[model samples]
Target: MKKKAFKEILKYVRVIVFFAVITILVEAVNYVMVQPGYARYIIHTVDNPDDGSDYDCIVVGASHGRASIDPHYFLEMEYAVNPINMCIQGATVIDNYYMIREACNNNDVKKIILELDYQYWNKNLKRDSDFGDLLVYGQLPFTSLKMEYIVSQLMDKDFRTIYFRRYAFAKNWKTAKKYMAIKKTDEYKNFQIEGVAGIETEGPYQGLGFFYRTKVTDKKGKLNPSPWTYDDLNPKVQKYFQKIVKYCKDNGIELICVTTPIPPSSVVSGAANEADTYFKQICDENNVRYIDGNLIKNEILNVSDDDFSDWEGHMNGELAEQFSEILTEILMKEDNSEYFYSGYDECIEAIKVRGNETKVLKYIRAAVFIAVIAGLVKCIDFAMMPSGYIRYIIHAAGNPGTEEGYDCIILGASHGRSSINPKHMIKSGYAKNPLSLCIPGESVVNSYYILKEACRNNAVKKVVLEMDYQYWTNDEARDSEFGDLFEYVQLPMSKVKLEYIRDELIDKDFRTVYFKKLAYTSDFSKVKYNIKTKLTKEYRDYDISAVKVCDANGPYMGRGFFYRENNNDHKCDFLVQEWTEDDISRKVIKYFQKIVDYCKDNHIEMVCITEPITPTAVVKGPSRDANTFFKDICSNNNVRYIDFTLLKNDVFDITDNDFCDWEGHMYGEAAERFSGIMSEVLANGNEEYFYDSYKAKIDEIERKKS
Candidate 1:
C-alpha cells in the first residue's frame, strides 16, 4: 500500500516537474527570440564597458548631443579622452539621469558631458518618452539599474509597454527592419565587411557622430524653429535636473551642461535665448559649469547664417568638427586629472550580464508551484490550453519515432484534405501509411513549406498533392481553420519556420517567434478552442483507423484534413462568389514549379491531382486557366498531372449533395469515393483508371462517354 501511495505521489511530482520545465523553456526561448536588434556600437559598449574598452569620457543626451559631439574626433585629435556619443534621438533629461547613472557604473569615467537642449525640458520628466528608449534598454545589461528602471516605469508609466520590445523599438523599427531585411542580399553581405559601427565618413554624412545636412537656405528653406519660452520649463523636469547634479557631484564625475550652437533664426526668435538663460540659472544653482554656444558660436565654432541650416544644426560638418574639439578641450581642462581605471573586465561582464539579463525566468519554479496549486483548485489554466490543431502541431514538433517516417504523403488545402482520405489510399493498396499534411487556407507557397517540413522527418517517396484550383492563381492561401497559424505554429520551430516568417509572412509577426506557445491564441476561435480542449490528448488523437489527425480547433482538418466534416446536411450559398484569374499571383506558379523540382531532385515521384470542384462553382475561364496552369507546371517537371475537376461520370459524379458546405469540400462518402478514385489511378495507371470514370465501372462509363 505504501509503495502504491509512493508511486501515486511520484506521478504528481513528475507532472509538477514537467510544468516547471515547460514554462521555463517557453519563457527563456521567448526572451532570447525577442533580443532587441543588436547594433554594432551598442553591443561593443555593452560588452566592453571598461577602461580597456576605451570608453572613458562619456557624452549623454538627445539628438543635439549626438550630432554635436564626435568620439572619433577626440580619439584622433585629443588622444586624452576616449568617448562614445551615447546620445540617442529624442532623449530627455530624465533619460540622461538614468543613462548617466548606468554609464558611471559601466565605465571608469572621467567626466560626463550633458546636452542641455531646452526643448527637452518641456517633456514631462516623470514619464517615459515615446522615443526609442529600447535602444538603451537593449544596450544595457541586466543590472539593478535596469530592474529599477523597469519597475519605476511600470509603476508610473504605461506599465505593460515598459517590458514590451515592440513598443520600445517603435521609433527605430524602420532602421532595424531594413538592416534585417537586406541581410541576405549580396549588397548587404558586402556592406557588412565595411563594419557596422564607427564614423559615417563616406556618404552625405561627411563627419563622424552626425549627418551633415546640407544648408538649403542662408537659414530659411528648411529652417523650422521650435516655439519655446523660458517659462515653459516642465516643473517635474526641473526637479530631476537637480537630481542629476546631486548624482554627478556625489559620484565625483564633473558634469558640464552645454547649450549647443544652432541657427541664428532660432536665437533671434527668443526660444533658444530664453531657454539658455534658464539653463544658466539652473547650472549656477547646482554649481556646475555651463558652456554658452550662442556667446561663442562665431568665434570658436566658425559658423554663419549660411552654415546654420536648421535649429538642430543639421547643416554644417564644420560646426561639428569645431564644436567637438571645444567640448573635448573642456573635458581635458576639467580638474586636468585622469580617472583611475580598474575593473575593466568586471565592468564589461557586469554590463553584458545586466543588459540582456532577465530575472523573470528565475521565478518560473515558483510560478509553477503556484500554478500547480491553482490548476488543482481550478484558479487559472496553464498555457497547456492548446487547440486541437495546436495539439497536433506540438505533437508534430517533438515528432516521436512513430510519426517521423512515412511511405506516402498527402499535401493540400481543405479540398484535398477532405477529398484524399489517407486510410483509403493505404487500404486500397495504393501506398503504405500516408499522413495528410493539409491545413486550411494553404496557398501554393504555404504547401511548399509544409511539404518541406514533412520531408524533414518523413522519408516520403510518393506525394499525393491536392492541387487547389484557386492556388494556381491565388498565392495568398488562408486556411479555413486558423488562417496563417498552421502555416507557422503547426510546424516545429526550425530554419524553415524562420524562413516562412522572414520571406513569406508579410506582416513579420514576431510574436510567432517570441510568444510562440501563445501566438495562435490571439484569434478568437483558437483561444476558445484551446480553453475548451486544454490541449487534451483525446481531442488531438491520431485516428489509427483513419490514418488522420483530429484537431479540435481545426474542425475540418480533424479527419487529417484541414476542414470540418459533414454529410451534405447543411449547404448555404454565399452572396456572390466565383473562381477568377484576375487575382492570380504569379508567385503561385513559381511555387508549383519549385514543389515539382524539389520532388524530382529528392527522388520522389510527384502526382499532381486537382480534386473535383462543384460543377456550379467552376467558372469557364478561371477553372480552365487553373487546370492548364497546374498541367503545364506538372508536364514541364515530368510529373503526372490528373485533372479530376471534370468528374462528370456516373460513379465519380459530384453533385451538390456531395459538398459539405459552400466552400465545396465534399462529405465523408464523397471524400471516400474521391480517395478511391485517386488510389485506383495511382495503383493501376493515371491513363487507364484515373479520369472521372469510376474504377469498378470504367469500361461502361468510357463507352457511355464515347
Candidate 2:
C-alpha cells in the first residue's frame, strides 16, 4: 500500500515540476527580451550619478515637472540648494512616494518638490497603475522596497506586463531584434545614460532627469487643461500624498507641492483659481508650502503659447530656462507674493486672454474642448478595436432577431456554431424565423448576455442552449476578465450591458476596458489598415461580407454561423480531457441556471442540446455524469434536455471523418446533415430519438459501422 501511494504521489509531483519549469523558462525569456526604455535612464541616473555626489533637493512628479524645472539652473544662479529632477514621466502619487523613499535612502536629500499634475489625481480620468508600475519595476534594485512594490501594485496586473515589459514591441521582429541586440551591448549592461538615450529618438536627455524638447507648440493649437473639482479627488492618490508628507516630516525634509506653469493658451479662464484654492486649502492643512505658476505675474515670468512644446503644457528648451530662473527666484525670495498675481482671473487679465474674451466665450471654449475630447475617444475606440466576428455579431442588425422576431436562436461555443445552421432549420419549415448567435469560444456568461441582448431588441420565442462539457472544467472560459473584454467593447449600450459592465468589468484591468487594442494579439502593421477600414462605407454599413470573406473559416454563411469546408483527408484523433466531479465549475452552473430562469421568466421555451462528437474521442471520465447533471437541471426546470451524443444510430451516425478536427467541430457537409436531423428530433420531441446512455450510443455506432 505504501509503494502504491508513493507511485500515486510521484505522478502529481511530475505535473507540478513540469508547470514550474515552464513558468521559470517563460519568465527568463521575458527578462531577456524586455526592451530598455525611459525608466532605465531615470533610475540609473539616481543610482549612478555622473559626479557621484549627493543632492540637497529632489523634484518628484510627472513629465510636466521634468521638462519645466532644470535643476542645473539652481546651481548656475548661485543658489545654496543643489537640486536633481527625479520627476518621471507618467509617475502617479504612489510612484512619487516610492521615488522619494528611494532617493532619500540613496542620498542626503533635504527637500522634495512634488510636482502636481491634476490628471494623476483627478477622479474621472482613467489612470492605469498596472501600466505605470510596469515602467518603473524592471529598473528597481532587488531590495525590500522593490519586493513591496511588486507585492502591492504589480501582483494585480497581467503577468505579461510584469515579465514581458516590451509586450507591444514584440509584435514587430525588427523592433524586437533591435532591442535584443541592444540588450547584448556593454552600455546597456553597465546602465550608461548615453547608450540608453541613443536607442530612441526623443528630446535631448539633460543629466539629473531633465529632458529638453526643442519642438514648440503651434500657437493656433487649442490648449485645454484636464478638469479639476473638489469632489473629484481620488482617495487612493490622496492617501499616497499624505504618506509623502508624513515621510518628509519624519525625516526633517522640506516638502513643497508645486503646479508648474502652463502656456496661457491652455488655461481655461477661471480654472486655475479653483485649482489653486484647493491646493492652498490642502497645503495649509498639512503645513506644506504650495506654489501656483499660473498665478505668477507676466512681468516676473513672461511666457507665451509659443514657449510651450505642446498644447498639453510641456515646455520647450527656451521656456524651461526662463521658467527655471523664475523658480530659482521663488526659492530665493523670502516672500514670493511680490512676483505673482492675486489669482487666476488677475493672471488671465495680465496675460491678456486672447482678444480679452468674455466669460461666455470662456465657457464656449470649455464646451468645444470637451466635444473634441469625446470625438477623439470615439475615434480611438474604433482604431484600437480589432475587426472580428464578435464585432460583426454585436454590430449587425439582422442577428437572429431585430428584423422579425426569431422563433428560435442557437447560442453556444464554436462546436455548436460550426455544427448547426439556422438556415437549415428554417428551410425544414419547423420555425418561421430562426438564427444561430453562437460565437467561437463563447462562455455561458457571454451567452446569457447575448440572449439578454437578443430579447431586449426583439421577441426571442425560444433559446437553444448548447452545452459544451469542456467549458465546465475550464475556469478561463467560465470567468476570465480578459476574455470578456472582446465582447464587452462591441456590445451596444443598454441596461443589460450596464449591468454586465458593473458585474463583469468594473474591477478588471482598466486596459481591458479603455485600451481595447491590448485585449488581443494585433500586428502593428495592420493598425493603419484597421483605422482606414473603420472609415469605410462597408464597416459603417455592417456588411457581413467584410468578415465572411476575411474570416479564417471558409466563410460566414449568415446568422452568426461560419461554414468551414470538409477536409477529406483529415481524421479526428484526439482524446477528451478527463475530469472528476470536483473539476466542474459552480460559476458555469450558476450562469447556466440564469439562462434557464431568464427564458422561463420571459415566457419563452428553452432547450439544452449537447452536440454530437466523434466516437473515437470519448473517454472514461465524468462526461456521463456531466451529461446527466445537465439532464437533471433541465428536468427539474421543466425544460427539454437533449444530448445528441446519445442520439440513436438510426437518427444520425457520426464518424471521425464527419468532423474537421479532433475537437468534434463539424465541417459544412456534416453540419447540414446534423442540422436536418436535429430539426426532425425537435419537431417530433420523441423519447425514442436518443439511446439510453452516451456509452450505449457509441457502442451501437461501432457495432453498426463494423
Candidate 3:
C-alpha cells in the first residue's frame, strides 16, 4: 500500500511539471512573434528614403532643438543628412544624454548635432523626475529594468494600437475595409515614400520674409533672459554628457555641437552668451568640434522672427535650409575626412533605386500580410472582443468624420483648448456653428496642417487662432508623444513649407519615438482616459468665493467682497501669470491679427471675447493686460470684442470660491453663470452672420433656461 501511494504522488508531480512547461512555451512563442515586428517598426520608421540609416545629423536638446533645425534643406542639398529631432519640450541635459546613447545603439547614426541652449542645463529635479530617464534607452537591454515603465508601455492604447495594427495580425478591420472600398485607379501601383515625405508642395518659406528682434536687457528687477546659468549641472548629468561624446569618439561617430541662433529676448538676458561659453568649454575639454551659431550676430540678424513659426530665436524650415547650406559649406571646407563612410555613398545610391521601385509594393504587401494574420487571430477569438469601443475612442480623440460644417475654427496651444468654451457659444448664439479644432500642447506648425485638413472638408468657414506667450519665447514646452511637431509637419509640408521644414525640422535619431512610446506607454490609460473624467468632476463644484482677486496695486482694499490672501507663493504655481508686460501685449496682438486675416480671407464674421473669471480674482497684471491687448486687437481688426470680466448682479452671483481648479480657469456655478451670459449675447443678434437659423436655437435655449 505504501509503494502504490508513493508511485501515485510521483505521477501527480510529473503532470504538474508538464503543464508548466507547455504554458511557458506558448507564452514565449507569442512574445517572440509579436516583438520582432514592433522592434522593426521602431527601427525602420526613422530610415531616410534615400538611405537606410539613422539621420545623418540629429539635433538633440529641448524646445530649442525643436524650433531651430530643419532636415529637408539638408536633403535638398544632397548632403545625405536627415535630421531626426529627438528633442523633448522642457528636456534636460541628462534626458538628452540618454536619448543620444540609445539612438546610437539602435541606428547607424553618423553625426550628432547637440543644441546647447542655456535651458538645457537648467536641471529642475521635479521636471527631470516628471520627464523621466527611461525615454532615452530605446530598445537597449537595460530598459526592461524599469519594469513599471514597461508595464505602462504595454497598457498605452495609442502605442499598442499603432504598434499592433502595423503587425501582420492586428490591423484594424474597419480601416482595411475602407481601403478596399476605394477602387484603385492607376494600372501601375504608385511608388510612395512611406518613411517620410507623404505629399510634397512648394515649401512654406519661399518669399515670406523673416523678422528679427534685438536682445535688450533692462536694469530693473527683470532681466532680459530671466535666468541664465548652468547651476543645475550636477556631477552625474555632466558625466553622462561626457560619456556620450566619448562613446561617439571611440565608435568613429562624429559629434558636432551646434548652438542654434537665439532671439533678441534671450540675448538681452545673456542666456545665449552663457550657453555658448558652456558648450565651448565642453568641446575644448573633450576634443570635440562645437559650432556657435548664437554668436554669429550678422547671420542671425539676417533672419527674423517671422522666419520661425514660434517667433522664438530658432529658425523655421526656410531659415533652416539656408543655415544647413551654410553649415555644409563650412564642414565640406573644414573636414571632408571626418564624414567619409566606407561604401556609404554607393549604399545610398542603391537604396534610392530600390526605394523608388518597391515603395508601393512594400506598403501593399505589409497591409495584406497584416490582414491575413488579423483574420487568423479573429478566428481564434471572435466572440471575446467588442468592436464599437475602439471606434468610439477614435472618434472622441478627434478623428475627422465625413460630416462637415464649421465656421471660425480655433487653433493654438493648450490655451485654446482650455480657455474656449464651444458648448457655451453654441447655446449663447455667438456662433451658428463653430468647432474647436484645438489639442492640448499643439504648436503653430502642427496646427497649420490640422487647420488645412479641416478646411479641406469644405465645411469650415473661418479660423480663429489663440496664441500662447511661450509660443513666441525660448521657454516653449516640447511634446514627447509627437517627438518634435516641427519635424512631423516638415514631412507633410507643401513645397513652400518643405524648404524650411526639411532643413530644420528633421533630426538624427528615429529610435527616440519608440523609446518615448515605451516610457510613456506605462501610464497610457491615465493620460488618455482618466484625466478627462477627473477634470470634469473637479470643475463640477468650483466655488468663486474662495478665490482672491488682485490688481496692479495688489489685493483689493475696498468694501467690495474680499478673500483672505495666502502667505505662501503657491497662488502663482501653475497659474497663468503674464511674466512681463511685453509678453502679454505682443502675443495677444500677433494671434489676434492672424485670426482677423483668416476670417477676412474666408469671408466669415469674427468675434473676440474674454471669457469670465471669478469675481474675487479678476485682478490686473498679465491676465488683465492680456484682456486689454485683446480689446486693442479687435479695434484694429474691425472685429467685435466683448469683455465679460465683471459678471452681472441679477443674472447669477459668482464668487472666487466657485473656481474648480486655480485662478486661471472657472467651473461649477461660475460656468453656468458664464454660459447664461453667453446665451444673452447670442440672443442680441450681434453675430447674425454666423448662422441663418440662430434665432431658433437662442429661443430654444432661453426657453430651456426659463
Candidate 4:
C-alpha cells in the first residue's frame, strides 16, 4: 500500500514539471514572432548612424545642453572633435552620469562634456533618481554599481520591460531570424556614410515618458521646494554615481562635466545654481574636470525665458549655435590634446558604412521580436477569453512626414516670426512673387516636415530662416504637438532630413513624465493656488496685444528705425563688431548654405534681408550688437542681404509714437512709411541687380492707390 501511494505522488510531480516546461517554451516562441513596432517602446531605434569613433567629445546633460550645443558648429571651427549631444530631457545628474557611461562604453570617446545646470541639483533628490542610473549600470556595470541600485532596477517596470524585451527567449529567437535574413543581403552593406552627425540620435520611441511637477504655494507663486523636499531619494544612488566616475577613470576616458545654458528666469529660480553646486562638488571630489556654462550668467541670461519651448527650461536652436561655438572655444583653449581625435574624418566614413549594416540588422531583429510577442499575447488572450470581456491595446506609430521642399522656410521661436514680414518684400516689389511659410516657436525639428512639404510641392523659392537665441539653447521637446504639423502637411522623411529630425527633434521634452511626477509632490491647496494664479496671469498678459496704427504721411508714421548706424557703408553693420562677428556670421552662412544648396539643387534663387529696428533702441548701448550679429550673418551667406539697422536716417522724421508702440515693431503709421521705403529699394535694385518686374509691380500698386 505504501509503494502505491508514493508512485501516485511521483506521477503528480512529473505532470506539474511537464506543464511548466511547456509554458516556458511557448512563451519563448511567442516572443520570437512579434513585430518590432509592437516592441519599440522597449527598444529605441537609433536613427543616426553611430560611426564607432564618431564622437571624440560627447556632451551629456539635461535639456539645457540639447538646445545650447551644435556639433556642426564645432566641426566648422575645424575641430576634429565631433560632439554627440546626449542631453536627455528631464535628465538629472544621476541620469547624465549614466548616459556618459553608456556613451563611453559604446564609443572610443575621449572627452565627455556634461552641462551642469543648477536646477539639476536643486530639485528634490528623490525626483533626480531615475532609470539613467540603471541604464549606466546595465551598459557599464564595472564602472558604476550599488546593491540598492540593483534593487531599484528590479522595481522599475519600464527598465524590466526594456531588458526582458531584449533578452527574452522568444524575443531573441525573433532577433536571430531577422539578423539571418539581413545577413543574406549585401545591398545595405555599401551605404554612403555622411560624417555629419544629426541633432537627434534615436527615434521617437527612445524617450521614456517622464514628467516632473513641483508644488507652488499659490497659482501665481514661483516653484516651491517644501513639498518636494520630503521625498528623499534612495541613498544608494550616490554610490552608483560614484562608481560611474571610478569606471571612467579606470578606463582612461577623461570625464568632463558641462552645464548647458538656461534662461534668466530659470537661473533666478535657483535651480541652475543648485545643479552647478552639485556637479562642482561631485567633480571636485572625484577630481574630474568640470565646466559649468549654466553658471555663465551674463551670456546665458540675455536670452529670455519665454523663448523656451512650452516654458520648459531649455534653449532653442538659435541659442545652440552660439553656445556650441563657445564650447568649442573653451575646448580649444583647454588644449586637451589627448582627448582630440585626429583621424575623425576617416573614422566617420568607416562608421557610417558599418553603422548602416548594424542598424538594418537591429531593425530586423526588433521587428521579429515584436511580432512574436504580439502573437503570444494574442493567443493567451484568446484562450482566456470570457463572456462580455475583452482586452484592447492600441499603438500609434509611423513617420511624422516627409522632408523634400522649400528653398527656404523661416523657423522661429515666439519672437522670431514677429521680427520678419514676408509681406514687406511682396509689397516692396523686392520679390515679384514670393511665398513665406513661417511657424512661430517652431523647433528646428518641427520645421523638417514643413520644409519637406515645400520641397515636394515646389512652393518655396528661398527660405528666410530666423534663428532665436533660445532655439539652440535647450533640449528638444519629446511630445511636441507641433509634430502634428508634419503629419498633417504630409512631409516626407528623406534620409538626410530624417537624420536632422532624429538629432534635433527626437529628444525634445527629454524628461519622461513618470520621472517628473516622482520628483514633484503637492498638497491640494498649493496646487489649486498655483493653478489659479498661473491661469489669471496667463489670461491677462500672455496673449497678443491690440495693434496700434499710426498715420503714414503724418510725422513719418510708416518709417522704421534702426538700432545702430551703418559705419561700414555696406548698408549694414557687418564690419562694426568684427570680434564676435564670426560667431553670428558662421550660423547665418550655414543656414543660408542649406537654403542655397536646396535652391541650387532645384534651380531657385535665394536672397536674405534684415528687417528694420528702432535707431534709438539700437544706439542705446547693448542693442547695437543685435545688428552686428545680423549684418555678419548676411555678409557670409552671399545672399542679397539688407540691413534696415541704419534706416533711421530715412525714418528719423517720424515720431517715436507714430513709428512704434514698443521699441522694435511698427504699429499704425510707421508700418506704412517702412512699406514705402521698401517699395523704393525694390524698384531701384541698388545697381547690384535690376528687378524690372518688381518695379512694374510697385507701379501697379501705386496706380491702384491713385
Lowest-sum lDDT 10-residue window in model 2: 544-553
Pairs of residues at least 3 apart in sequence or in different chains that clash in candidate 2 = none
Sort by TM-score, top down from the best: 2, 1, 3, 4
Query: Whose TM-score is greatest here?
Result: 2
Give the top-scoring candidate (lDDT). Answer: 2
Q: After superposition, how far is residue 50 of candidate 3 from its true place, in Å?
A: 49
What is candidate 3's CA lDDT for residue 398?
A: 37
For model 1, the superposed segments whose C-alpha errors exceed 4 Å read 1-385, 393-404, 474-485, 498-502, 505-507, 516-570, 574-582, 619-621, 686-706
**TM-score of each model, paired residue for residue:** 0.42, 0.54, 0.34, 0.33
What CA RMSD would you report for each candidate? Answer: 25.6, 10.8, 23.5, 28.8
Indicate the residue-level lDDT of 362 in model 3.
72
Question: Candidate 1's residue-wise lDDT over 474-513, tens digit each?
Answer: 4333422234555565566788787777665533343333
The digit string of per-residue lDDT tens for model 3 on 109-214 reads 7877777765545554444442243333232244533343346433443443322232322245554433332213231113222211201221332211111212
Where does candidate 1 have its weakest 10-residue lDDT segment? 336-345
